[model samples]
Target: MRPNVRLELIRKLMQQHNNPSFMKKIIVAILFVLLIVGGGVAYYLYNKGPLDVISSHAVEISAVNLYNSFLSDSAAAGKKYAGKVLEVSGLTEDVSVNQNQETIILLRTSVEGAHINCTLEDKTKVNANKGLIHIKGICSGIGDGDPDLGLPADVYLTRCFVINK
Candidate 1:
C-alpha cells in the first residue's frame, strides 16, 4: 500500500511535468480573465460610484428616463438603479399631487413634446406653477406606466430634495 501510494504521487508529479504547457496556458488564461474583470470592476468603482445603500425621499427627472426605458423594456433593468440619487434638467409639466399628497413633476424632454411620466415617492410635490424646472430626488422605479397614462413611470422616488432652476 505504501509503495502504491508513492507510485501514485510520482505519477501525478510526472503527469504534471509532462503537461507544463497546458498548465501554463491555463494560468495565462486565468490571469488574463482576472485582469479584464478586475479592470472592469476598478473602472466601475471609479466612474460609476460606490455601492452604498441609497435611500432618498426625492430624486431627479433623469430617473424618469431610466425608469421609462426599463418599463418600455422590463428585462433590461435591475433594482440596483431604482430610487437612487439623480441630477436631471428638463422642462417641468403636469404637476400632480399623489394620494400621499406628494407633488410629482412631470418632465418634458428637451425634444419637442417628448414627455416622461414620473412620480415622487416621499417628496413634497411643490406645484410647478413655475414652469421648466430642473429636478433632483430619491425615486422608486416601477414597471412602465400603463398606456392611459402614456409615456413611462418606470421609477417613483419621493422628493427628498429639489433644486428649481
Candidate 2:
C-alpha cells in the first residue's frame, strides 16, 4: 500500500531473480518443457508416411514445354509449377540410379543437354529403355545451369511414379 512497502517488495523480487540457483531452476524448467515439445514433434513426423502420388491429381504437360516455360520466365514458372504435382510426358533421354539408389529419369527436351529430371519412387517399376513415358511427380523447380560450362538448365521433379495410360 505504502511507497516504502512497494519498494521493499520490488527489491525482494529482484534479489530472488538475481540468485543463481533461482535463475538456474527457471532456465532448466524452460529447457525441459522445450525438449519435451521438440521430441513429440519429431516423433509425430517420424511416424508419418510419405505422400501417395499415384492417386493424387496432377497437372499434365510435356517435358519440352515445361522446360521452355522455365527458360522463358523462371520466376513465373516456379510459382506455377514448384511444389505442385505434374504429369510430364516426353521421350526418355536417360534413366539411372543415383548414389542414394533412387531411380532418376531424364525426359528429353529439344534444347541440348536440358531435360526434366524425375526421381522415381519405385525403382523396379520403370525401365530405362522405354522410348516414351508419362511420369507423375511433384515439381521441385529448375536447376540453373552454367553457360560457360555448356550445361543446360533442368526442371526437377521428386517422388515420381510412372503414369500408366
Candidate 3:
C-alpha cells in the first residue's frame, strides 16, 4: 500500500509538470491580477483633481527679470522656472479676453513687442490703470518670435490669478 501511494504521488507530479493547461492557468491568473492592478491605477488617476495653484507656494520674480533669464539662457531658465508657479510683478501692457473667453493679461517687458502673457484661470477683470500688479501662475516658458515681422520673444504663463499685494 505504501509503494502504491508513492507511485500515485509521482505520477500526479509528473502530470502536473507536463500539463500545458496548468501553465495556461497560471498565466491566466497572473494576467488577471495585472489587469486588476492596472484598472485600479487608471481609476485613481482618472478621478484625481486638478492642481490648486491658488494655495500652492510660488517663486516671486519680476516680469523683466524672468524674461531676461530666459532670453539670456533659455535652457537654464526653463529648468528653473518652467512648470513652476511664479508670482510675477510687472506693469500691465494690455488686458483682454481671448476667443476662449479667458482673461489674458500682457505684462510689459524692457524690450519692444515683448510681453509676459498671462492667461487667467477665471474671467476676472483687471484694471490696467493700476501700476505694478502682481500675478501668480505656472510659467510656460518663452515663445519664439518672428524677427521678420518685428516681433520679439514673449514669455507665457498659464492658469494665472491676480495676487493683491
Candidate 4:
C-alpha cells in the first residue's frame, strides 16, 4: 500500500511537469481576455459623450433648493446630485467665461448662502445679461473657492445647456 501511494504521488508530479503548457495556455487566455476587455472599455469611453439632460429624464430642482441642500450637508448633497443630470431653474446672477472659454452662469440663492455655478458648453446660447433661466447641466460638485486663482465659487455644474431663458 505504501509503495502504491508513493508511485501515485510520483505519477502525479510527472504529469504536472509534463503539462507545463496547460499553465501557459491558461495564462495566455487570461491575458487575451483582459486585453479585449480593456480595448472595449477604452472604445466605449472615447465615443460616449456627457449625459444629455435634454433628452433623458433628469431631476428637476430649483436653484435655491439645490443650494440649501448643499449648504446643509455638502457630502450628502454631492452623493445625491453629483454626476447626475439636473434641471435647475433660477435667476441668473451673473454670466462670464472662464479661462477655458466655458460659459459660467452663477445662480445665487441669497446674499450669504451658497450659489450654483453652472458652466455651459456655448456662451452664445445664453445671454450674459439674462434674468431668470432654466439650465440643464451635470452637477460636478460643491466648492468653497479656487485656491489657485482665489475665486470663491460654490456648487459647480458642467456640460450645461439653457433650456429656457
Highest TM-score, which number?
3
lDDT of each: 0.57, 0.92, 0.92, 0.83
Score residue 50 of candidate 1 by CA lDDT. Answer: 32
Q: Residue-wise lDDT of candidate 1 within 1-165, one digit each (tens)? A: 699999999999788867979789879999999999999999887898433323434333463465456655654544554546665555566678768776666676433334544555445437666465555554455544456856534344444345645
Candidate 1 versus the native: TM-score? 0.42
Per-residue error (Å), model 2, residue 152: 1.0
TM-score: the better of candidates 1 and 2: 2
**Sort by lDDT, top down from the best:** 3, 2, 4, 1
lDDT of 3 by residue, 1-165 (tens): 699999999999888978999978989999999999999999999998977899999999999999999989999999999999999999998999999999999999889889999999988777867488999999999999999988898999999999997
- For model 2 the local lDDT of residue 18 reads 82
TM-score preference between candidates 3 and 4, better one:
3
RMSD of each: 13.0, 9.1, 7.0, 9.4
- Candidate 4 residue spans exceeding 4 A from truth: 1-46, 146-153
Pairs that collide in candidate 2 are none
- TM-scores for all candidates: the values are 0.42, 0.69, 0.73, 0.64
Superposition TM-score, candidate 4 onto the true structure = 0.64
Scanning candidate 2 in windows of ten residues, the lowest lDDT window is 121-130
lDDT tens digits, residue span 88-154, model 4: 9988888888898888898978545457889886667567665788988899878776658756558
Q: So what's the TM-score on candidate 3?
A: 0.73
